[model samples]
Target: MLSLFTIISFVSIRLAMQHLTSLFKCQVFTALVCLLLMGLPGQSYAGKILVYPVDGSHWLNMNILLLELHKHGHELTVVRSSNSWYVPEQTKHYTSITIPTSHASNLEDPEYMAAFLKRNIEIRSRDRSLSSFVALQQQTLTLLMEAHNASAHMVRDILHNKELVKSLKNARYDMMLTDPGFAGGVVLGRYLELPMVFNVRWITNSEGHFAIAPSPLSYIPTIGSHVSDKMTFVNKLKNLLHYSIGQYIDHGITRPLYQGVISEFIDPNTNIYSLMQGADLWLMRVDFVFEFPRPTMPNVVYMGGFHCKPSKPLPPGLEEFMQSSGEHGVVIMSLGTLLGSLESEISEIIAAAFARLPQKVIWRHLGERPSAVGSNTLLVDWLPQNDLLGHPKTRAFVTHGGTNGIYEAIYHGVPMLGLPLIFDQFDNMVRLTSRGVAKVLEVTALDVDTFTQALRDILDKEKPYRENIRRMSQLHHDQPMKPLDTAIFWLEFVMRHKGAAHLRTESYKMPWYAYHNVDVLAFLLGSITAVALLFLLTCRGLCRVACRKRPRDKKTKDKVQ
Candidate 1:
């Protein structure tokens, strides 16, 4: 009787354990469902998304977000200019709308763009004086205006295209994704009566900050200023001056152009500020690690590394070249898309530097092959950039400091040797150098010896650079979701919530002085001045009373005597 009782007890215990295991598994599955549901509140709903990228680089940056949206059952359409970098095949889920743009016609020749940039760089390098800086600023503004005009012309063409207009009217896109760099998106959004979201490819510019959020010049460095958040007194003054004068100049030049474009399609009387300020959200491609700490609005999302992906297997030739380096490892060099080819002199210097290095080199060169190429160097017209960066054998990256390239290098934990040439490149290099993960070499002053030494310094200090990058990589990856995933989630959130108007800061509506509390300062100053004047008047009245009484008292005393 005792044995039989014991056996029954054992069987009951085993059955109970099996039941508990099933319950745990059920709970786990339910929790996953809750998480996914939390990320996407209205998963069942979808909306049409219209995207207009500013250039090829901007288009590429938008690809991941577009793909994720498509995967979630949203309809996507992209408008491309004739010079658009994105091919139809690359954007699998996007309907391509090709339009003839005047900018495209003028910039169709890659060589022309390259030469134009080269000339500008040469001019600025020739004279680094204040006058040269002003000239460069003017040159930059002129180029920007030309680009804006091109964009406006494209918009006019689109509006005039009868078939396209008919199709757009029928489609009824839910939201418009645009690059704030191009004002045409503003016109389109107004015409369509859709909320606009900006996918800012670079650091947030003054216009963006002024319109979408408040970025204090005191803490937030102006774009291309090459200063950090913590500024010296001189730097602070310089930064303030740059922001003030730069905004005045930019607005003066672009306002008319923006008005011109808006007049054609929307109400001519509509304030350009209203159109520019209509952005519902701004998805900036910057990370806190790469940028200095500053106040950011809820509507401004940092979607840095949105273009990063898991490393794929390298091509056979590329793999072979990397493997050939063995213990020495390989170095990847590229100047990004804009300056595809380098001047022969610059190329020779780079090639000669690579020849002296123990590490094998993969140089992305579009120009004539440099005669200085060594056996260890492989010159290719194009490279699998991200893939090569992710390779275990890659030692260091020699880059032109494009934002995309910098992010990729950081994402892959590869140190950089920055050869900054123009625009934001210098600023990017400054950030990298400040972080101790890279060194900068001026393109204008680059020689074989200097280039080689820069490379060597990066290589010699590999341990610390790698360690710093590793820390940044960890921080960058330590997020609730991947950058691309976060971008898509917010995008869908905006759609479901019918625009993120609540997230926008009141600062956007504030005047420049009001936003910065300059009005408050003025009020305080006026109050102090009034008080000071009152005190002065009081003192003067007391002095007159004392003098008059003393004379009267003296006269009375003489009379008594």
Candidate 2:
């Protein structure tokens, strides 16, 4: 009985030891799997992204890009002015930090922005000659300077806020994303020693483009030139002159203003262009379809339609209006956020033109309702512009040719009749018109009859415009991923590759003459000149020797005779 009990006990002990070994192996395997999974793509790569936005439209553009990153598990923090646009409630992943500044608040106020724009428009309307253009440039520079001053104050406040800076430093943000419109991002990024990605809102300013890549003034049009890559001699001359003027303005006027402001917070030696050049990526808000074909650096990514998204259901009123339009369809008219309302005379003319159309007009009017608006026109304080354009009933769009508006119209295949009111809108309109996708009307010369005729031309006579827009729309959408996704992928790519410094072009570091090889041309010219001079001197010396030898030979012959 004792031997049998001993044998059973030995077997049980062996079984227990085997069980323990298996359990230990299972835990080790599980840990290995967990570590492997954690190291895999899309598993453990969440980064904190900081955004600095200038205003509502700027925020709107950045928000779309950040939303995608947020959806992918990145944390986003936005630093904005107190009076900037309201943050959407659905942005649960976004944290907003406000800089307190009455100047910033007033700058963002619709009335204030509108007033500033109106003064310039009034000046342009009164004088349309070269003087007017110069004056407009001066006025624009003044406004920009004022805005920069306000932004500088705001940035100073943010920098001086020790608590905020401490918290931000503690957070250890992975990257800084900014519009670069106000140039505050450059200062902030430099101060924080963070890699920056510039979201250029429009076609890059000529000087800024020169600082980043090879933007030849001969072919590449200046920001407001309204010319194409293929230029006439006169246009090329204009482009060169325009570029020169812009450079002077930026360097002579704007640079000082930015320097004075930015110097207060960061190193006074660091200029805005240097900070901009140091950026890891430049996400230009332009595409080849709308912009002229030009050589771009690897770090520059074209994200034209980044703001475009799948259309949501329109508001009840807007939906009802669109559905009721039946076969006539609908027209969307908006001047965008910058201009709150048109002059009363211009408004009346636009209203008169819309009244004559068979299509229903949904005009975004902020001021008092125009008395001339007919039954066919629906005036609203705001409109879901993209959603309306996506609607099947949307036949045409009358707009200020803002970059966002233009992209939205192209995305939805809606034809446009553009009345450019300010700055780059003129160029945007000209590009669209050149592509056979839209007609541009001069607001200064706007009359009821001309306005109505232009509207009719786009809405009724211009079938090709619709077709061209459709084609462009298809081209814009025909990509490996949507533009928003493309932007997100590139953003994440920068994060994954640690700034993608390999993609930066050497041109960014080169001086203007060196970048375009003007120095090489000069060197070749100098060499040729030196060679010609040496040859001339050698021939002259030979001639002098021959002359002296002949005289001596004649003298010797005469003496012998």
Candidate 3:
């Protein structure tokens, strides 16, 4: 009986041991499979990203970009202020940080900045009078200073924030993309040692195509450069003067303050514009259709059409209204962000212009109803601009020449009647006009008669401008990839390569004079001066030697001998 019991116990123990060993092996195999899957790039390499918008609510372009990027599986962190009107409802997808921007907006008061700059320039230029030169100098200084301050504050805040900084340290980003309007993005990008990219709201004609700095005077004032198609001598001088003054302000005041504040959080090596200089990519939100042909930097990528992704379904009475306009086509009218036809006179003039047009007009009038709007015209506070422009029935656009408006029209292959108001709108219209894709009508020159005639001529039988629009449409779409796809491809490409060092060539790799195109003139001037000095020295030596050892003249020969 004892032997039988021992045999039973041993068999039971052996069976239990075998089952335990099989379970252990299965668990190990499962863990190894998980590790292998996670090791793959598509699973493990999703990175952290931060997007900073200066005017977050008004940043329609950047907002659309955020949507597109979110769709790509990026973990985005948006840092905006409380005053910003547009808030994303879905915070689950993004890590939204709402910072108080009282300091930010206060830093941008135009009058205070302008006055401070005026005083500074008055002290520097020794001109008490508020002349146009002084005015220009003051305005330029104000813009630069505002930009400098905003950037400094933003950088300091981000780097000093215990949570933000800690997050950055723990979870390094793959890239930083921003609108140039945000000062801190460039600064923070540098601090975090990530690749930086810029999205310009305005297109460039002379002010280095599409990368937003201060608005170039040639474009701002609507003045064409007679000297160089890119920039006039005066424009170049203005840019230089602005840059010098700005650098002085930054180095003298802004940098020290920023460095002191930021040192407590980040490394001391961060300089103003350090991130911008270190950027691996710069994608401009400028479409070729809006800007005139000019010099372009290799780092600059035009991606204006990327954000033209349309919103939801069209509102009531839009489709039928467009259909009733006729088989020929319809015209859409909108004055962009800043300017509005709120004033009675401007509204009346616009109303009269639309009334005279035979084509149906969809006008975005933000103010009170005009006493006289034609049966063919429909007025709304806002319109689905991209959707409307993309419609086959849409023909010509009457606009204030905002970059967004220009790109939408171009993307839809519609011609324009640009009535530019302020800022780079004037330059945008000029480029569109020069390209023959659009005609420009000055806002100051607007009247019922001229506006109507211009609209008629564009929609008329000649159709020269329509052909231009078609050509540009083809060029815009003929790219190897869509603008959004291209941007995403490059962004991911940079991340995969751990920041594209090959793309970040030092601006000074070519000599300074060569970079600025001053080498030829510098060499010529240097050569001429050297030759002149040699000639003068030779003449002086010859004169002295002749006096000392020349054959005596007839009058003085006997005396010399």
Q: Which candidate is the best by TM-score?
A: 2
Indicate the TM-score of model 2. 0.84
lDDT of 3 by residue, 1-561 (tens): 569989999999999999999999999999999998766545344666777665632367777666666766778887765544555534655777776544555333434433543344334344435574556555544555565566566566666678867777677777777655545666666667677666654211124332223244453332322122356667677555544554555566556645664566555655434434456777766665555445555666777678655434556589888888777678999886543454566578878888877789998886588987888889887788888998888889999787778887887788999876544566677678778888787564468888888888788758689988888987887777789887776767766777777766575234447756698888999999999999999999999988977555655878877
Clashing pairs in 2: none
- Per-residue accuracy of model 2 over 1-561 as CA lDDT, tens digit each: 569989999999999999999999999999999998766546366788888876756666877777678778888888877756544433476987877767664446667678877887788888778888888888777766677667666777778899998888888888899877777767787788787888884422452355576667778778767787778999998788778767776687657766865677676766776667888988888777877777778888888888887788998878998999999899999999777588899898899888988889999998788888999999988888889989999999999988898999988988999988877788888789888899998887899899988877777743688889989999888887777777888888777766878888665566669977999999999999999999999999999999999999999999999
In candidate 1, clashing pairs total 0
Query: lDDT of candidate 1?
Result: 0.79
Ten residues in a row with the worst lDDT in model 2?
201-210
Candidate 3 segments whose C-alpha is farther than 4 A from its true place? 1-45, 56-58, 87-93, 106-148, 201-271, 287-290, 294-298, 309-313, 508-561
The list of candidate 2 runs beyond 4 A from truth reads 1-43, 82-91, 100-107, 153-167, 207-210, 260-270, 517-561
Worst 10 residues of 3 by lDDT: 203-212
- Taking the tens digit of each residue's C-alpha lDDT, what string does model 1 give over 182-267? 66776787788787788884422353554655577777777657787778988788788768755664567656766776777787
* Model 2 lDDT, residue 471, Cα: 93
**Clash list (residue pairs), candidate 1:** none
User: Could you tell me the C-alpha RMSD of candidate 2 in Å?
Assistant: 5.9
Q: For candidate 2, give the lDDT of residue 254.
A: 54
